[model samples]
Target chain A: MIQVKDLKRTYVVGKVEVHALRGVSFEVEKGEFLAIMGPSGSGKSTLLHQLGLLDTPTSGEIRIAGVDVIGLSDHEKTIFRLNQLGYVFQEYAILPELTALENVYLPAMMRGERRVYYLKSGIDILETVGLGERLHHLPRELSGGEQQRVAVARALVNKPKILFADEPCANLDTESSRQILELFKKLNKDLEQTIVMVTHEEWHKEYMDRVIYLKDGLIEKM
Target chain B: MFEKFRVSLFLAYKYLTGGNKGITIFTIFILTLVFLQLVLVSAILGGATNRFNELMIDYQTGNVVIEPEEDTEYISDAHRLMSKINALPEVTGVSARIKGVGKIIYEDRSVGATVIGIDPLDENTVTKVNSAIVDGDFISKLDRGEIVLGREISGGYGALMESKSLGGVKVGDRVNLRIGSVDREFRVKGIYTTLFFLVDSSAYINKKDMEDILGVQDEAHEIAIKLNPGEDEEEFRKKLMGIGINEEIRVWREFAGIVELLTRTITQIGNILNLIGLLIAFVIIFIVIYINTINKRRQIGVQKAIGIGSNVIVASFVLQAIFYASFGMFLGFFAMQYLITPYTVTHPIQLPIGPVILSLSNTEALFRAALLFFATILASFIPAYKVAREDLLKLIWD
Candidate 1:
């Protein structure tokens, strides 16, 4: 579902060049529940962003479902990310002003999808995530676990081929984190989605099918 | 497009009302500035018109002043006095008067004067000088001693140098009127305000009294005619002008350079002020919108990251600016009409304000002001465009 060819990414911070990812290449198949684990400076989130088409690599190319994402225009890349990759950030990117339903429908709206279609798809995603009853509630009104679940619903509403959940449970308490991970695990199994999550929680290992340990930008199969 | 816009609008409305304190506070601030500027413009124009009307009627109306020819002493035929000029469409009414310059001597003091004798009803029917009589009355009772004086003479006697003057005497007093070569006695039944300091030294009575003083039978030294509205006033005067029988016909507007100049300057100043106000309002709106856009850099970045295209995000800001301008203009317009117009109507002389007054009647005044306001809002697009195309990486990292 996702492939990288000697992907290199560099950063310029205060007149100094820092190599984030140097010639890293990897591939992940469809319906795989993969967790990318790494310590600080391991470029875990950066790699995830590159894979999700949120960040462009400096050299080489990233192909998702046979399309090279690096060559896509800004607008095309956005649609690719919207229809193919769904993101669940550590801090829920659920807009505070939006209700749970609006938040879930936001990505689809951003993609300029039909309202009737997105509404139905959004409802289904919310139902699957067990947030169908709380669709009218705002993010602030929802529990942390519920808010994270709404973010998940938003990601999956467009029926993205893959989900990139980057430390989604980092801010949650142990119970909420367990519940969130359980929801993700269940969705991964039931929906057969290709999810590549980036996180460092050792306990989260139990919920995943396999893990890719990233050290110094190199993916080591573990 | 509509659905996306509707969704964005819903989110904006929700945030505006529901604890999105930054945008809410910012909107109110913008509204206040726009309102303040609009009020200032309306007040200036309103006050000037009131003052001009009072000044015009008192100093220069019935505007045609007919003087005698080099050889002819007085206009002999009352029938033909303004007949030729009155034939024009602008001629509303005419009044004839015989004025004789002389010295007015009271018991204790003697002052130089021009004795003006007018037909009481005719004078009133032509010029609105009757409106300025702040004293006893218009020359209703034209007995010998009845006279009107200007505030300038009234000041000489420690009186109120305002609208009215009775020479420190009551309604029924004795005024000694004398012609330059012949002395004439007239009874003062009422006092009127002449409004002009020069005219105040002259006393107004009946033509019968002037005929007695000048000893001229059925004749007047000057003929005054009031022109009607919507008459090509200058052309009308020019057609009847050079035909002045030993005299010339003059339109008040022709020699009214001071009033006209003052009026034009007032209008010009008003236009400039309105433009300046609009410019300031626009700049303020632009800056405010720019700052709001800047503050939302993070939100912009997040939207871009989540597949919200650059064009869509920028279009949203443009839409928001248009929203602000439309709302601001409406609020500003209403505020100016209600709050500022009333004040200006009542207080004509607000110091630095004469210029704006003249613009009140200008045909294009309101339209230009509106145009200026809208133009200012349109100029806000420059700043909005700049904000829309800002570097995404700079926003996310910064």
Candidate 2:
């Protein structure tokens, strides 16, 4: 479960202050698949970043699993991110030097898991994402859709409590985008995995348990 | 800490061997060449100094020497002092010499040379003068009236001699010697060379002949003493002073003032060379790692975002530097031990002081290797820190 109370974020470009999030507040219960929909610069990605502990909020309170995470130190935040949350970026940000298996197991490795345990878990997750045959291929050798599947497998390998995806299908074709969305639906239903996704597509609303729309920096509709 | 180090080491090894094989091999080659240069520069300087010291000890000064007292032309009661010195437990051999300046004339050519009168048998014990003979035999008695001409005095064509010829004086040729108001004729028994300019320009004769010519019988101008192996010359000098001998005593190091200065000069040059080597290594590693980390800036940010600490990323780069430096130094050690040292020892480089052979002690080699390793660490640290501290969001997005 996640909770946010009046979270705000701002950035200074040259001398002007741009408020990316203006006291926006929201919550998602455990096992819920949520999507945040908005136009460009609606603070959708900004809100996700703040909730995911990727960046600090200008002013706000954020609690995950009933614990205040806003006050955690940098080191504590890194540990929390490693043990409790995972991220899937739009660009398929797998390390080029690592094989698909290496990329998937990296987060588990960072969590101080043993190599054999993480390797087995990573292979199982890759198989679930239908990438069992490409475990040894590098990111560059994989097709765009396959690379995205590897990224998804990597995000799920650590068995985190929540997965944060920022425009995961933004760079995929129509068919790949539909496949990825179906994969997310299956993960949510079969594994009871909780996920928060940001997207601009209107058709993805059918798969989400709930959809929140934003205009400018505040919640406009739900 | 061990876990972190293991992960770092794994990442470093993977990155090093994974991509751009040409660049990796080129960088390693450059490091190997630099390490070899550092070893050779220091070895050559040390070799030159050691060669000079060996020559001075072998051909000129023994471990210790006693000269005439200040303001005295010759030592008084020289035979009594010699006997006392020879009685010491540390003394190995003692040679008393009568030194005088003389003009030598042979076959219408003449040159001024230092004439030394030495007891042949005793002189052999103090210094390897007999082994230096290049022509004819050494004088067998103190009254042979035979003179051994130094290679420089006889031919005047050697590393340390002037170009003026001595009329091509050869063995079995008779030469005239004039010291003060005494003139004598003696046959040139042999030509000997010590490879030292000063020693090779002097002539040696029977001690009895020198006494008769100079009218200073039963006195010696110098007494050279050779000590047993491992005996400390300065300690023995103090002990000899305890015997109440009234003469100026000096060690071989003190007698060879020029060689001492040369040793210090070479050591200072070696220090400068080491500094230059360090600077070169630092710059090379800095640039190599800087470019490497810069290329991986985005990957570094992604790693940080995925809960990897900055320390782990920095450790990976440092480990890469350590690998390159350690491997290069290891190869350099083998090259010095198996290739350079043996070749130089067998065919020494001819120098003005003497023949120079490479010298590399184990401690010296290890110290240089460690110095280079630390320098590489520092070099890699600077760039790694810069890359590690960058804002992750900008790196990931930009």
Q: How many clashes (backbone N, Cα, C below 3 Å) per candidate?
A: 11, 0
Stretches off by above 4 angstroms in model 1 are A113-117, B1-4, B20-30, B54-59, B62-94, B97-117, B134-149, B152-257, B267-297, B314-332, B335-398
* Candidate 2: clashing residue pairs, number: 0
lDDT score for residue B44 of model 1: 52
Clashes of 1: 11
Best-fitting candidate, scored by TM-score:
2
How does model 1 score on DockQ? 0.40
True contacts kept of 2: 0.46
- Evaluate residue B207 in candidate 1 and report its C-alpha lDDT on the 0 to 100 scale: 76
Query: Which segments of model 2 are wrong by more than 4 Å?
Result: B62-95, B100-115, B121-126, B129-193, B198-203, B213-257
- Distance from true position, residue B17, model 1, in Å? 1.8
